[model samples]
Target: MRDPNPSETASPFGPVISAYSRADAIADGVLVPVPESIAKEAGFRFPVALTSAAWADCVKWTDADSEAQPTPQDETGRLWDVLYVTAHAMKKAPGDREFEVRLYRVPRDGSTGHAKPARLKSVIGPGDDLSPVITIMCPDES
Candidate 1:
């Protein structure tokens, strides 16, 4: 859906976020920059809360034909301190779209490089003085 403010837009699937610039941070806030092509295909001026990606040996998720559950494991096989960005995106095409907000690991190099996926545990609502929070269960957590 189109937002009243042209500078920002809402995600049809998840939280509305502006385009990610060098200044944006994942842990700092929820807003993040996603693949422009993906955003364009999803008809979102802003970045979606979640998207599929593969980095180095890390694979958040892929465009699988079937909807199978993900294993309770990370790409690293161990835990790593990473930034978490919650966004949403259209899984498929417009006519047959599946909107979802999956947590993604923001790369440490400040570059949208080969980042992994953060296991989605829960979606927490914003507090009286807080915004929407996406709770991710990282491997590092006991």
Candidate 2:
């Protein structure tokens, strides 16, 4: 019979390999922590973070980008859009621990266009300390 707890069983392959924690990811800039006050305003009771890819896709805006694009946009507005949509989605499904959310945001790329639709995945899971937390990331990201 196999052990239900893998940690209790001896691995045939040998000792455990390398592992990365959520804290490590945040420290390495792979994940960016959203301000607690802003996250609370967006209806998140727990800590929230965004994967670097998602941040680049939606939150990273600059004056140069606004000048290049026809529509004027700012980082605050972009981040709010993401958080608002994600929060609404979570409210719609209160029982789900993990789900995907679709939101529209203007692309930061130097292009003239309207807000483009993007899919973000919201996961409510345990953090480094086994505390509930939320992480929003692009569909392609982990």
Candidate 3:
């Protein structure tokens, strides 16, 4: 897709993020030089929130086609803290696309990913926050 601002055109898809010099973005599509106000928030991490774009986007080979590589389970078969960014690339080609974010863990480093099928509940305009806030709701319902 064409960048809205040509003066600062070009974006990342991982692998070559370190050379990113734009004040507006980081490698893997994150907004760079993270806004100071956001950094001052109650809780934050070294890496800012993932941008609508993921580290990489493609027609993914998920489930059994890609799931058995390795996982993040412990000896007792419990999951741990290594969460990979699993996102859904919504929207058709031409206009820029958007991603729905979630954190998933693997027992090891190379497990094929599993993405449950989802239906569009509503049309989210653009950017993050498309995810709904359900303080308490049944997993099946959400």
Best by TM-score, which number?
2
**How much RMSD separates candidate 1 from the native structure?**
15.3
Encode model 2's per-residue lDDT on 9-108: one tens digit a residue.
7787888689899999999999999999999988889999999999999898999898998888999888999899999899888899888899888887
**Candidate 1 lDDT trough over 10 residues, lowest sum:** 77-86
Local distance difference test, per candidate?
0.34, 0.90, 0.28
Which rank order by TM-score, best down to worst?
2, 1, 3
TM-score to true structure, per model? 0.21, 0.86, 0.18
Candidate 3: RMSD to truth: 17.7
Q: Rank the candidates by lDDT, best first.
A: 2, 1, 3
Which structure is stronger by lDDT: 2 or 3?
A: 2
Tell me the TM-score of model 2. Answer: 0.86
- Candidate with top lDDT is 2
> Worst 10-residue stretch by lDDT in candidate 3?
75-84
Model 2 score (lDDT) = 0.90
Clash count list over all predictions: 9, 0, 11
Across 1-142, the per-residue lDDT of candidate 3 in tens digits comes to 8768965654454346453332234454443232334433422222233222221121122454245554322311111111112212222222333333333333232544442332212122322333321111112222
